[model samples]
Target chain A: MRVTVVGLGPGAGRDLTGRAREALEQAELIIGYTAYIELIREEFSHKEMRSTGMRKEVDRCRAAVEEAVAGKDVAMVCSGDSGIYGMAALVYEVAQEYPPIEIEVVPGITAACGGAAVLGAPLTHDFAVVSLSDLLTPWEKIERRLICAAQADFVLCLYNPASHSRPDHLRRACDILLAAGKAPDTVCGFVQNIGREGECAVLTTLAALRDTKVDMFTTVFIGSGQTRVLNGKMVTPRGYLQREN
Target chain B: MRVTVVGLGPGAGRDLTGRAREALEQAELIIGYTAYIELIREEFSHKEMRSTGMRKEVDRCRAAVEEAVAGKDVAMVCSGDSGIYGMAALVYEVAQEYPPIEIEVVPGITAACGGAAVLGAPLTHDFAVVSLSDLLTPWEKIERRLICAAQADFVLCLYNPASHSRPDHLRRACDILLAAGKAPDTVCGFVQNIGREGECAVLTTLAALRDTKVDMFTTVFIGSGQTRVLNGKMVTPRGYLQREN
Candidate 1:
């Protein structure tokens, strides 16, 4: 029996990759966060499912591995790319204690990439992705990363920007970038519920994003020094064709 | 009539997202670099194709927009995520000069994300992606980003690592990172021809990767201080469950 860790992309079924879709279809058991399971349930109702709430990642991974070891094809689903703040690492870490099983990780369109498409090309150049959620990582560490990335002029892609308990994390992150010399007028944008219901994108500035209310479902893109607004879309040039000779 | 900038997702057809496939099927004209055009020719042969050689990005984008303006459903193909070092920005930039046309950028699996999965979750934390090619970006700026990212302890994903004209860029970038105080034994890996023919992943240390030969098709991952080799996979913990209390 084999285990495939699949990234469900951002939201919509069409956003899911053919490879990932095939993996989920072939799985006898599919496990994921409750919200993610509900997202796929309508399309894959026939597959056996084990759904858990948030913060139960370790237990969820263990469940998938046990099912795989029991001779059932299993797929552990996660939103966005499984390897990026998703379940890929946890699955690998937990599978260490389980019986030998063939494990494969199928990549998906991460929020950074998916949200960037909706906002034009905000990540055309070198960029950094830092999740603002402090659930697992220390706040100090997250702050340090935000400051360093901003100082380095790396376009920042902030994931897990806000939650019920972490309402102020995104604002604090923006302040750190501003303190690191990012201009207040620097172009920035965010997309809420990308590729799903309530999908919307707002083009704003660094200062505005700091003040705007956002939620956990949003992916914020803070542009670098070179980012600009073109016809209401944010874009960061790759620095190749536009360079002065 | 619209322009859909499609990301082919690494190199495999199955890796292509359903959304991208639909865009290609609806495209009356498909245009891209010669290599990328040939890569998808078998599946998309029915569409009229316009292929060009390297460094003709502006010309290729102009051709796509022109076709779209002429009432043709156009799809401009890019190798990875169109927004990340791909043609999304160029498409938007060029489309500005033509007649108003509805433009949509389809996201795909960028090389860094796709290659990371093949090598096992090397991008599980805060990370930065910098292309080593000096074609559009000045070498001095590239070096600065490499040094800054290294100093910040951010895992570095090097794209376009080597080309015929700049064979020494990867080695020099590694030197800068090593000089920035990164440990010599840091876990580093590279995937060549990701999702395509001749796909291969090499796991090594930072010091060893410095002396190794690479090509333009390779995506090199320099692990952060938190990264490790679990079993045979390069894994970087996200610091959630593995954090010190």
Candidate 2:
């Protein structure tokens, strides 16, 4: 009767919100990217699953819309929040081509939040979420965002920092941050695999992060000018205690 | 044994992830701001609850840490994601002076994500999250962040957009954005009381939003250059359908 676009959080079962789990549990069919499907394939073993390979976003969404239009209750899952770099917008866009159907978006914890927890609180203040993937956006635009975010001293959460086609993108982003008046020693961190196995988090300077190689599964964080490393954890104070003085 | 910082995800029980609920249910005491405590007090009526009034973040977190250090498992709840403008960082900062007690941050659906879901997929691309309140952070710093975020065309999710002391902040920010070359017709939206009683979502333009006064309870979304309104919903495309050509 309706299509629910669900965000499954970063990874692992515990991160899934109550509503997201309930939607997935009640859905007659679940659809998403092949890798995202693999995340919950075991949890919802009884439900019918449909998936498509990478770069097949449009087709995947169309299939979901078609199924929903045919009276099948569907849940299209995405990693992180379904509304952030996920399938929620595409579903709304695709659903326009079909009969009217209710579309509900179930929000989940995105990488910025999940990774921030593992690396301490680098996003307690104002921040920007940028993706280095140039497959869809131009590198020049990405460069500008890095510069602005750095110049303004906003904590930066970089997504899709590296990929096969853009293996050097993380380095390039780091360079942009460095060039945009950000100090080379700015506290930075990256988390790999998030809640899933092999999940790892490391803290380093902006200079060191440039040399560190990470895969597509990694999420990177660059601290603001006010950020600091205390007790080996990177944290950007919200300026509450300081004002208490 | 540990202090679990949980994000309540807007203001609804359905928005609480399974992990967050479990933490609250298992905790011996739940602590947070007075309003946030009231949000989940009914759901976990069996648990002991403690809260502090506004601007008492330090006292509140210190209390939570004291409770945990005394061997009672405690959960500190925040309205949105505990990491973003939440108490996760403050807890880590306060725990430094005391004995090393386990500090775990359970990520929840932040306002940006929860508000985006109600307003449609306006944050499907990269964005910046900025808070207008300058109670702790100076006003000048907030001004620069607004200018830079607007110049870079990053979709902006604004928190605490207006308050009694800063009633003109949102309008002032819009003036800066307009001065920074953002179009007056730029798509914008705001959601009040997200996921709670009297919840309302409105779609407009930057020009209109500047005049639409909002309280701290509202989360405002300003679209990037690529954002649009389709079928009465605001959406910022990830450039998928366009790239298919």
DockQ of each: 0.74, 0.83
Tens-digit lDDT track of model 2 for B117-169: 99889999999999999888898999999999998999999999999888998
Q: How close is candidate 2 to the true structure, as a TM-score?
A: 0.98
Kindly list the per-residue Cα lDDT of model 1 for residues A5-28, writing each as its tens digit: 898899849989888999998999
* Interface RMS deviation of candidate 2: 0.9
**Native contacts retained by candidate 1:** 0.70
lDDT, residue B126, candidate 2: 90
Error of 1 at B59 (Å): 0.4
**Candidate 1: where are CA atoms >4 Å away?**
A240-245, B243-245
Which residue pairs does candidate 2 place in steric collision? A17-B17, A18-B17, A18-B18
